[model samples]
Target: MFDSLQDKMESAFKNLKGEGKLTEINVAQSIKEIRRALVAADVNYKIAKEFTDKIKDEALGSKNILKSVKPGELMVKIVMDEMTTLMGGQATGINVKGNPGVVLVAGLQGSGKTTFSGKLALFLKEKKSMKPLLVACDVYRPAAIDQLTVLAEQIGAAVYKEPENKNPVSIAQNAIAYAKGHSHDVVIVDTAGRLAIDEVMMTEIRNIKSGINPTETLFVVDSMTGQDAVNTALAFNDVIDYDGVVLTKLDGDTRGGAALSVKYTVGKPIKFASTGEKLNTLDVFHPERMAQRILGMGDIVSFVEKAQDQFDEEEAKRLEKKIKRNKFDYNDFLQQVNQIKKMGDLKSLMGMIPGMGKAIKDIDINDGAFSKVESIIYSMTEDERLKPEILNMSRKRRIAMGCGHNIHEINMFVKQFEQMRKMMTQMSKGKGMERMMQQMQQKR
Candidate 1:
């Protein structure tokens, strides 16, 4: 996401490498490079300068206090703290708390507002245990209602839209009333967007906000717009005074300017970040976690949270029993793969692990990587899926033809699956660790 900025920041830290302590000379050299990195990431030069200046002061002030810490490590700590503060020190949650909490969504054209509306509905539905009504108030664009309807269908949320009603304010008010009658606890009103800032769009959005009296108003912006995104946010805030910001298209070639500068310029916390096109890819923005990722320190906590979301306690217990009995078959394997897919894209999930981002930066890992294995599993009959040992040579050949894979590929997959099942059984029985210790002692 911020690959270029991450590389440049790494280079900046190299200046302090092998140094005994932080000095004015080395600190200035590093700060200059840090400022250059921020500017290259499309951050405002003025904000970058002020940001690095704070880092310089912090580094110099703590030079002697932490003599035991390495020079490079100390500088990284100082910069991480400053960057977290620059990006709104903590996560700010949206207020969806009312009889029927209303959220007003605003942004420029092509900022993914409608998509985010659907994602927000799914997030609230799955995470917050609240029923969210997706209100399609974007009456300007063609088929905008249909798009929202499709998204709402995907998330299984109720959508309120007046196909013939052009008045957004009335549509929003009516949507809230509908939500109350339908027992929807939250209402997300997706409003129209403009190609550029204009009075007409502003007035329409202001009127909608006034009519709905939303518990929270969010300004969604395309993060790939760089500093222009920040400027647009400021313009919108001046009009409607949004409660928070939402950064979309964060998985694109974003230079990190919008995320780094929006809070400082618009005086609003970034409430959410849309990493991928998947509705499940929405994340609550955490400034400290983001700073760590920008500095090449992966967000392990977020990775765990994503996994935990897909985790089912009863399913885990069943799978554990199966593995312990060496009964983990194609069915179990397929189920595990589906759960991982629900977490997010493989590349993004890996990026959340510590030290995995740079390792996989150049690798072309995606959800497609699972297609071959899935095809193979899908080719198997229900009986074959439930029983691994029943696959004979003839059965393997038939399955290979069904899955469009070669016989050798099917054989290799079967062999690997058996090995994995055996190892899991052994581990569950406490024999795997004991065997590993014996092997180590024998090697010694």
Candidate 2:
């Protein structure tokens, strides 16, 4: 998640930390370092230069004006502002205005188009209270339809698919009519993807665009692809002129180039970012938060907003009751892990936390980390899962052998689980959890 870019930018600011005042020479040197850092992050050459130039001017202008703020703090503020401007200065949202409003999802192969479609449908259904129909427009691959079906089922959204229809335009049109008949408020069309930008593919998508006239046509591109992603975005924008962009796979080792310059290059805002393959990992793009993240200041506000959107009130109350009664079990622990997984992969989500990114940047955190824990938990009998305290050494060893894990690992996990349950039960019994819930409800 732009780990290298964040490291370089943080290094750039370290040179100015001990300085007494923001002089012309010191400001120039710091801005130079910032520009180099952006270049290292694969940002476009001219945009990086222009961005730092603005920061330089701002830094110098603020030096003699503000007396209360320290030089380092002022410099950080200047850089944060310039970075925000570089990445569109404001957040944009997807438009679902029309009755049975249509949102066309277009992206390159493996860009997570189908997965994002499912996530968006669930977001609309749960967060916005809109009945959404998932339309399978990828007629090229039969498995694409199946993929959407699985995701749609998991999200509890209705799906429309025509396995025999070779034309995507027809499928989408029929799906829209079906949604109207079924009283669905929104229709999300998951279109086909290409290996690369091509004329035939562009023409076909353009024809579909002309037929559907979608309320929001999103150009989904892989942020990991860097400059090529921007180029593909420009190509697609030229043909269909999409409403917004979707940067997918930001949970991967992205260089931060595409996310940095896509809005500037295509002259369209990036409305959503698909951080992972999970159906609930989609987030509305916010330039200020992203700039803060790039500068190594965590975006806790955006993180909380994402959780709030996905968190169900009734489920939270049920979990609260369970924790208060000290009835938390391995099943509840597994459910919590699944919720975190849906927010994004564990590594990426942890990286978004304030200082954890710097601490764990070198570590390889992947899906395999969850696999071991899941296997160990699955090997436990239902009785053991319900009452973890009853697991003696013999029982623990047997469970360890059943899961093919070491006894030490199983013991460590159980210890952590027990500690977590204790902390949660304490919180549930006190006002701390109530206070937090009140604050969250107020925000809503």
Candidate 1's TM-score reads 0.96
Candidate 1 lDDT trough over 10 residues, lowest sum: 435-444
Candidate 2: the clashing residue pairs are none
Residue-wise C-alpha lDDT for candidate 1, range 310-357, written one tens digit per residue: 766667667777877788999999999999999987888888888998
User: Who wins the lDDT comparison?
Assistant: 1
**Each prediction's Cα lDDT score?**
0.92, 0.86
| Clash count per candidate | 0, 0
How do all models score by TM-score? 0.96, 0.89
Candidate 2 residue runs with Cα over 4 Å from true position: 309-332, 368-383, 421-431
Q: What lDDT does model 2 reach? A: 0.86
- Residue by residue across 1-444, what tens digits does model 2's lDDT show? 788888887777777787888898888888888888888777889988988888888888889898778887888888888778777889987799887899999988888899889989988987799999999989886499999999999999999988888999999999999988999999999999988888889999999999999999998888988878988899889999999988888877888999888888899998887776667677888999888887778778877775676577777778888888889999988887787666666776676778877888789888677888888899999999989889999999999999999999999999998999999999988867777777887787
